[model samples]
Target: MFSSSVHYWLEFYVGAYHALKRGYSNMDVLVALGTNAAYFYSVYIIVKALTSDTFEGQDLFETSSMLVSFILLGKYLEVVAKGKTSDALSKLTELAPETAVLLTLEKDGSVISEVEISTQLLQRNDFIKIVPGEKVPVDGVVIKGQSHVNESMITGEARPIAKKPGDKVIGGTVNDNGFIIVKATHVGSETALSQIVQLVEAAQLARAPVQRLADKISRFFVPTVVVAAFLTWLGWFIPGQLHLYPQQWIPKAMDSFELALQFGISVLVVACPCALGLATPTAVMVATGKGASLGVLIKGGNALEKAHKIKTIIFDKTGTLTKGKPSVVQTKTFSKIPLLELCDLTASAEANSEHPLSKAIVEYTKKLREQYGSPSDHMMDSKDFEVHPGAGVSANVEGKLVLVGNKRLMQEFEAPMSSEVEEYMSEMEDLARTCVLVAIDRVICGALAVSDPLKPEAGRVISHLSSMGITSIMVTGDNWATAKSIAKQVGISTVFAEIDPVGKAEKTQGLAVAMVGDGVNDSPALAAADVGMAIGAGTDVAIEAADIVLMKSSLVDVITAIDLSRKTLAKIRLNYVWALGYNVLGMPIAAGVLFPFTGIRLPPWLAGACMAASSVSVVCSSLLLQLYKKPLHVEDVPIPAGPGDGGSNLV
Candidate 1:
């Protein structure tokens, strides 16, 4: 409320200056100084009447009146500080929808008029239509269509999440593309956004770590001030002894005693303990806000503190450590026939496939034809093409039967293999690649390797983690050769290959891992790991199942989370020092222990000021976190696995 700083400055300080001019002013000083003097007179009268004449009323009354002004100043500062910290809540509320579209009863699914319904009027089961680039109206489940939603405002992740049928949609997320019909499950205060607001409110109501120290000091504060008051009375009273008789010295003695009592109350008035109570939370709130801007969502002080302790990081292969796209890595020849002829046979059989592996096969075949200057539409004998579940296919090529598949397929057909063929397969498999072997008329030929590329940013982020002394591991379902190659490219030393979904969890458990992933199959491992990291990228089932979700799919955000935790912990340490040091050095000054030796006693007013400054220092330090210099760069940071190889041994 003290918005006019100039006006406030001229009034309080000017009044105190004139009052101090009445050299060594007493209760009567206000009476002579007019209204600034009159205010103290009224307070003195009340104290004198209330205390029942046990002690003289002039000084106690004067100081209590000034206490009102000090308390008022404290209240004003506290409100202003609280308002600054709570700005995040107002920003969140601004995301709510102002209007919505309601479905009409026409034969075609038509809209009644565009209804301008306030967010509070929205209810569960309300169907809302969201077009491209609009914040969602309510927390709902998608009933139709698809789109990408930007959830950075809510989850602090920059990645756009893909929302399709059956996906849970949050209110206030921006729709990036396509159209969707959302059936509202929660609206108004029941939404996740509202829940965040409630949590912040509760955090505010909780006791601060510094307040306990203030309470303990305040208990002895009054007694210390009383002693200081007695010293003041003695300094003036002793010199005017009047030959040690009662009647002769009583009048002047009464005057000095009253003045000292007033001084005692003044010290108490100017030294309220409010600032001590606000120190920690203000800093934490500011830190949380700064982290939000940097794409890091720290849920609470506890999580923020624990994050810096991450000693090991385990990465999930698909959609996390890799680019989520598997392609042909290498092609080799074991047969006398041309490579183009083998691909033609393989493509024909895989043309109708929707599987990612099959698509990789088909694409590789097309590329081979283009590279070899052959026609891509080469026809195949469908009669010889056979679909092999969980294996490679068999087809006819140039009037001879050719097989393109795993080594297991050879066993299935009771086909015989020589030592050389097995040796070649062994070398390729060691690289963690998915090898598709070629057999011409039942004779082993060459093999094609399939692999998923490592994400460009994965390497860089992992290296940063390593520099922070956290170990990195890669887990994949690919063969040994392919996994090793990709891991080497990224510079990761630990690799687990050909791991089943269950095996992923078992391995994570064995290593005390923190599993990071973004798929349904990865969910179990994410949950089982010591710290589950779910990478959000529009539709990461793994993120939903994990403990810590990275709303941004970038590996850099993962590193950002780790950095944020460390910095926050640092901030907390500073906070603890501020709290601990203030109390440690503050109590003795308040207790008047030094007055006997040096007479440099700490007045209650000065003690209050020091406590306020310490608190404000903590808050200001936290606010500076907003100016953090590091920008998040997710360039792939390769982490070498040292030679641990890929996948599991269950096969």
Candidate 2:
């Protein structure tokens, strides 16, 4: 019978024994002490009844059962709440299509046949076709046709983007119109969609810096509560026996040693370290999951915790604040060649080049060809093509030497430039435009002005940062005039121009800098900054180096990320305040501080309820972050504004 009885309470027995064996005490040690004291006293009462037959007192079997039951219930509820915090990550895994439609084209470029296959069978260089109202199955570049794809899943951009033959498409976006034939560039896990899901999962599992303090406090809290409970027993029972208190002041029930024991047990049951331990981890989990749903990929908790404290946000001018692709805005001619003919010639020379400016010229020429009929019967391909690094391309079109590039390319061919052409190029540079010189047989024909324009939301994003008191700074390798011109358009006052890759990193030193960039050269600066944010549509090097990645590649997402961080941190602070407040107020009352005055005391069961409620309150408070919405306007209560009645920058 004794062996069977010990088996039912085996966990408590083993826990108490282990605490003594290890010569250390934790929350388990305190729990063992409380339950063992009640259980052993009950056994002694039963022993007296069995031997002497004079025991009429009660055994505290219910006390041990109630303590274990409520604490176990609290732990079970905590695990359930923690699972809900990571729901966003698990939902992302269900987005990709399971199957794809493979396509085989005839030699004449007509569709020969189509086959349905699993997405796992897709490989690089394979062709696939996506119809209207179907999700894309893999990451690839469009080779035929155009469509508007909804990329809300990959990037949080709600608007559908127009995709042409040369545009790249993600794996999970929905195609709205037109049949698109794509040549698979990335398949399976190597796709950008998979990378995003992996990042979200990793971030949710990581620990935040704020959790360190909570963890350190919990290490000492359990043992301290155990000592406090012992002192509470000594304060109440020792005074009652020694006649230290007046007869009128002390309650008749408190005069018994059983009353002192009940008070000590209440203190042990009420002081919960579970709530304190959960204060930071639960908040971080919800914030990271919430960030993933908004297309802001915080790489880990450390980055999310650091984001709210940014004082200066440094922006890379190229792909971050402005469209990285250059577009042909204007073209000037120096000869009798028609404007269309000159454009066709320049486009032909740059057709084989892979530079962004070259692709821009090619795209412009194609758009013009669709609008107006071409002058030539057939477009001849350029031969003997050669690209001079940073200068331009030299090729032969229609057996004539065609040189299309910068001024340095023209100068190498001894192409004489008149003051009229020089003045035109200088004016283009002042407007933040790049001029590409076109020459035929050592003679300068004209210059095509290409400009990488600012994104439409750049001004509003900068204004939002200004309102938040975060200084906006532009860093770029462009010339001073061009950099300042773009910065002025984006509402930025600080400009760091004409700097090399290393110089950009050097500029972020000794400040709480959040560097926003999207290129290979930006990797160093992204790693060196306090918080590095990469554009999702940027290079792999930049994304890997950054701490956070904005998948939408919009400047507006930067504002969203910062606001989310501030709100998340605010939630963490609120949790800490509530948890500490609960312990500070409940511990004293449970220790019988008010029993001497009003004779008000908490029973063990009531203390159990309060302990369980404290943990649930902390979890529920963190769950509120799931409802957080990004403040779109100045009047929407910016998180950096802190909690107050009124403030400026509100409209």
Candidate 3:
């Protein structure tokens, strides 16, 4: 009895004392009550037997000792399982390389010296040399050489991407072949790997809305259980004293009071509030970690809980559904100037413009020069370069004025546009292409038709969402004709065009909406939606406003995020059912509800064992989320055609 008191007092009893002083009780209070009653009662029985020779009772010292042992053992197993649920976060934290090869550069950007140093000491503008099979130490742009990088850990993309000069490399990805020099752009906490780890940690600490029910029940669960146990004892003892049942119904070594004490102890130990407490949190932790591993960075339990209920998703047209990378498809020259000369002049004027269409024209001109065996860099330099928003760019190349823009810029400059040019622009617009009109020396000389292709998985993902009863809507700042054309090709029936940032948010006001976008302009709508998903390649503002980040930037992961949330909620429900069902049925039996019929009764030690098992069972059930797999087979999805393949007419 002394040993049992010491064991229970240090652990369960102490915990119960602190909790009660705070005006509350928990599962520990019930455990302490049950074990203390059995231990002290056994001491009373021993003293009575010693004082009176005719008195007889069976001491319950073993019951109390064994109950504490089983409960403690169950707690140990539960803690171990909970630890396994955060394995993804642990792995992410370990991905950063311990050491890096720092490069010292010359005045002209040539490497002069190299030394190995700890990655923690890295700083912005520091150059690093990465060799084959080594980890990229920080997020940076490649300055020299080329290689293929395996970014599976960071982006969840299994294939190795080819890296050349000017390509950005994320920290913690592996360099597969060749050597490269990278200039650090982001280090320490600013690195992508560190941000991902921080996101996962924050997500695990957040509580799901569904957990409130369990929390409310647990607040009163222990005190209500104590009352039930006392009533159970009264129900058994009073009946026994009245001779309402046969004396033989009692165990051979126990009397009415002793049998009633046994039933009360069973009731106290068998009701498990701990299982109810573990139900939602464990499942949420596992699901968040699983999402991190799959490149879907869920913000927390609230987002995870809400995503499953999304009925409609609003997608920004440019970077969300389309590639966002425009390419020149068709070029027409109307002047006496050759097509090559016109393209060179247009490419030179657009060289300083950052617009996607400008880059497409410049790239197309380079490729054309290459096909003709002319030097790609032979274009004359531009002077007085200017960007006209909603129009285009203006510059001077070789002492001649050059204008490259839409018809608006042409009319603004009083540049003449003939009937043929208007016809060409209409035809291109009908095909969902943006026609860029180029004017040289106040005469319309050429036109370049550029198109941004739809993502290969866009159509299939939309079809899948429709089957799942989720409606897809397209919202864009582009014209109605272009928006509808892109929407039709991607299987979406709804489209909202010429909408600005505020207008995009307004479209999501009356529905359970999830907004997916990738630019600074999309940040407002992203924050206004019920759930915002930002593409990983998007601007930082969009990512900050989003509830989830798709690191792979694949439309398919939109499906994965919703599917995982549905599965997680389902698992939490299952856990609650198991916990409640175990108590509802086990508590009655433990309270001697069956002893009046078949002479069956639950021992205090066995009841304690069942209670411990219930909590452990709930945690183990949640851990099963580690085996989650995305329903879609990414490999079977066909790749979208490139620019050379009929100019990506799908969008």
Flag the better candidate by lDDT, 2 or 3. Answer: 3
Q: Which runs of model 3 end up more than 4 angstroms from their true locations?
A: 1-24, 372-375, 378-381, 640-651
Best model per lDDT: 3
Q: State the lDDT of candidate 1 residue by residue for 387-491, as single tens digits.
A: 786666776656767676787888777667777777767765666556677676677666666665556677677767788788988777766666666677667
- What is the overall TM-score of model 2 with all chains considered together? 0.88
For candidate 3, the TM-score is 0.93
Report the CA-based lDDT of candidate 1 relative to the real structure: 0.61
Quote model 1's TM-score.
0.62
Model 2 lDDT per residue over 81-148, tens place: 66775555555656778999998888776888899999999999889989999989889999999999
- Show the lowest summed lDDT stretch of 10 residues, model 3: 642-651
lDDT for predicted candidate 3 compared with the true structure: 0.87
Task: Encode model 3's per-residue lDDT on 1-651: one tens digit a residue.
Answer: 777647655887788889899998887888788888999999999999999989989999988888877777766666666577556567777888999999999989887999999999999999999999999999999999999999999888889999999889999999999899999999999998988888877888899899988877877777888999999999989999998989999888789999999999999888957688788988988898888889999999999998999999999888888888888888888888999999998999999877777788888999999999999977788999999887889999998899999888999889999999999988877777878899998899989888887788888899899988999998888876677778887888998888888898888786679999999889998999999999998889999999999998999999999999999999999999878877888899999888888888999999988887887888889989999999775675777564521122221
For all candidates in order, the CA lDDT equals 0.61, 0.79, 0.87
Model 1 residue runs over 4 Å out of place are 1-55, 59-86, 89-280, 329-355, 362-405, 415-432, 437-448, 498-513, 528-530, 538-541, 594-606, 635-651
Largest TM-score belongs to which candidate?
3
